[model samples]
Target chain A: MKVLVTVKEVAEADDDFAIEGTDIAESDLEYDLNEWDDYAVEAAVQLAEAGIADEVVTVTVGRERTEETIRMALAKGADRAVRVWDEALDGAFADVASKVDLFEAVVAEEEPDLVLGGVQAADTGFGATGVALAERIGFEHAAVVNDLDVDADAGVAHVHRELEGGVEELTEVDLPAVLTVQTGLNEPRYASLRGIRQAQRKEIAAKDLSDLGLTADDVESSLTITSMYEPESESDAEMIEGDAGESADRLAEVLREKGVSA
Target chain B: MSVLVAAEHRRGALRDVSYEAITAGRELADARGADLHVAVIGGDVDGFAEDLNRDGVDAIHTVADGEEFDHNAYQAALSQLADGIDAGAVVLPNSVNGLDYAPALAEALGVPIVTDAVGMAYDDGLTVTREMYGSKVETTVDVAGDRFVLTVRGGEWPPAEGVGDAAIESVDVDVPESGARVTGFEEVGGGDVDIADADVLVSVGRGIEEEENIELIEDLADALGATLSASRPIVDNGWLPKNRQVGQSGKVVTPDVYIAVGISGAVQHVAGMKGSDTIVAINTDPNAPIFDIADYGIVGDLFDVVPELIDEFA
Candidate 1:
């Protein structure tokens, strides 16, 4: 079985984020592979190591700098890396529909037995891209999956989806499907020195949107941001200042005032 | 124009978030001067529909099929229902099932979507308020297109109340062949001591550091006569069972008094227990976001404070 894992390069905001024009400033951002996608990469790598999957190809949509993220995946054991970028997608990062369009094109090119992605990006947190990509590509999909077992011969995958209220739903999805993985699915392995050296030799292919036969017009956003600002602190919490003992005593007193403690 | 709310249910019982969606849908409908309609899809959902007939609801549409939630059935049924009713805006809970189908439904309908909306306003078009960067920043998004889809965050809106005699309408639609079949639900954490039932929650976070320290939190819970709960890390680390976890991916709990120990309070963790009446945060970091929402904060180490707290209560 071959697996295609979609990774994302997201900006980790500094202590403060400022909106430059319509979006956050690039300077105040430190970019890394999305926290959730690390789990997706780990899941794919585990499958390959267990011989359940013959190959794992990782892909991402970003500018030139995003190749670093794809390389990070390769270092974690992905067989190959592909970076999908287009000038047309410059500001299209905020649009799930457009991102889905680009990802669908990538999936068509890869033609893997399974496609996996982080349930949502750390930055945008859209959580819609994977399912939308699945819909656009006409594949069976599941979201927020914590556990996955693939039966390649049977062409079905048994997955455990994390639901609210600490309940998990066990579902069986037909193969050639897309799955958005949840966090804590697996502990992502650190890139070994040997693995890093091997990744440098691995081929990292780059694809433009035009190569996928998609135009900027074809991928347009239905939602637009009107304004961005810091959320005001709703509560003026009373901070009890003192050592551990004094603070605890004051907190207990406050609790008593609130009728929470006798 | 009609605002359609997709009611979420499990085994024929409506979830609390379903009512929250209805409340949000009512607000959107009123803003647009449109009628509010709810769609309940499941087997034996007539009772669920009847339960959804709250004030501001104009109609209840039921599709009696699929005992469990199937993505294909929900996507097909909701899109068909929205199309049939010419829905101007569709409101859904930002839940596991709702998030699963919302995007595909929006795509099929060719409508704009704003998900995880904590607040919303409609003036000619919809403007949704959402959190970004772990809820540190809030963004107000303006949606384009005449029709839109929104998934309201749970606990943001109060449940719809009062009574309304909504006309029940049964809709017949073809559910497409599902690519996935739900086998069954397995309750995590042994289905023991539901945190939702606890009036006071003694929650531990990553600051607890190690599994052995969990006994310290357990002792604190026993001192306060509160139930023991934890953040995702503790559960993910296998130090505590998954049921003790509280957060978006875990359980939304509204205990009367919540004491967060060694918790920095990420938005995901806060989302679960923010509804607690009195939140007492014990973290050494004074800048921890948990302190922002805490009713009373102790900027001290939980290792020291918790034992003292336990002794004080004793």
Candidate 2:
């Protein structure tokens, strides 16, 4: 079985993000693969390690920094990588529809048994790429997947979906499916010294829309953007004081004073 | 111009969030001088559609079919309807199911898409408000296009009201090729009330120490008739389930009363609950940021103060 995993680079969670004019402060912001996507890559590696799947290919759409994200996946265990390397993607997916067409082209060529992705990226957090690619390529898809186990012998994959109300449901589907892994799906493993060295020798494929036989206009935007701005500032932080017991009393009194509670 | 809003339902029942999306759409439509158009999917959603036929909506588009519930099929149908009606903008609830198809639908229709939108507007183009960087910052994005798709966050905008008869338009959508089949759906049931809808939420953080100590927080929740929630670390440690997690990576909630106990108010956790109507934080550290947005705060060790607070509320 062959697998395709979509990865992305996002500003690290610890980084301080600020919007300056129309653009974000990309300077001083350390970029890494989206944390949740780590689970997707790990799930593919585990499948290969268990001999339930044969090979894994990692795909990402971005500029030079995205190569780092793909490299991290390769270091873990993905067999190869493909980068779309578009500048518009750094801003938003809405401006880069051609990426979907490119993904569709690769899916047709690879004919993979399964496509996996993180439910949402830390940046933008649109969580739309997997579904968009799946729809464009005409494949079955599931979202918020917390657990996935492939029974390659029967050509079936069983997945658990996270739902509201602490409700979880087990669903089974056939091969050639798209599964969007949610956070906590599986613990991602760090790359071993040997694996890191081996990744340097692996193939990292590059492709563009022309190679996919699709033009940028094929997936151009239908909506127009007017402007982008930051939210207005609200009140600043209000500090409370005193020992545990005294503060609790003051809290109760304040709640009563605000008529929030009595 | 008429604004189009997709009415989302589960197993043929209109979801509460869809109403909120409609409320949001109605406001945008009103501002733009556009009539609202609601499109209801699923084989038996007409009955549900009737309940949503408010005054702002000019008509309801019904695509009643068994396959219409599937993401690709539903998205294809919506895409066709968007093209057929020449919709000004499409609205959806930024729910799990809606998120599953909204972007794909937008891509299929070649429209710009925005998810978890908290605000909306119409000028020369469509602009929306969305929280980013763990809710520490907000970004207002403007999409360039004639039509766009937006998935609204739950509770970001209150549900709309005022009822009148909306005209019905039965659209015949050709079912597109489907790649997935729902062999079955099982319901994973969380505890009684979902934290998202709860009026009061009592959440725990790492300072609780042991699992057994959870009972104290539970007691407080019981006293206030509030729901129980936790930070990601508490959930990650298995002290609470993922459903109860409150953080940027967890569920975003806008409850009426959110009480944080032993929580340091990490930015990630605060992003999920900061929209609450009233916040009360109880932590040993007086400097915890949770006190910033909190209407009331107690700088106390939860172990000593929780019991007394529970007794007072009880």
The RMSD of every model to the true structure, in order and in angstroms, is 3.0, 5.4
Error of 1 at B113 (Å): 1.8
DockQ of 1: 0.58
Model 2 lDDT per residue over A70-104, tens place: 78799999999887654333354344355567677
For candidate 2, lDDT tens digit of each residue in B61-180?
A: 888767335776678678777777677688998877787788778877766678888787667677787765545456677777657788898777776666858887677778765545
**Per-candidate count of clashing residue pairs (backbone under 3 Å):** 0, 13
- Most DockQ-accurate candidate: 1
The alpha-carbon root-mean-square deviation between model 1 and the true structure, to one decimal in Å, is: 3.0
Worst 10 residues of 2 chain A by lDDT: A87-96
The per-prediction i-RMS, to one decimal, reads: 3.0, 5.8
For model 1 the TM-score comes to 0.91
- Listed in order, each prediction's TM-score against the native is 0.91, 0.79
| Tens digit per residue, CA lDDT, model 1, B1-314 | 79999988876668899999999999988888889999988867788887889998999999988787888888888888888888979999898888898998888887767789989888888889997766656788888766888999888899999889899999987987787999999877657678989888889999998889899999888877789999988887778888788987788899889989998898778878889999999887665789888988888878888888777888
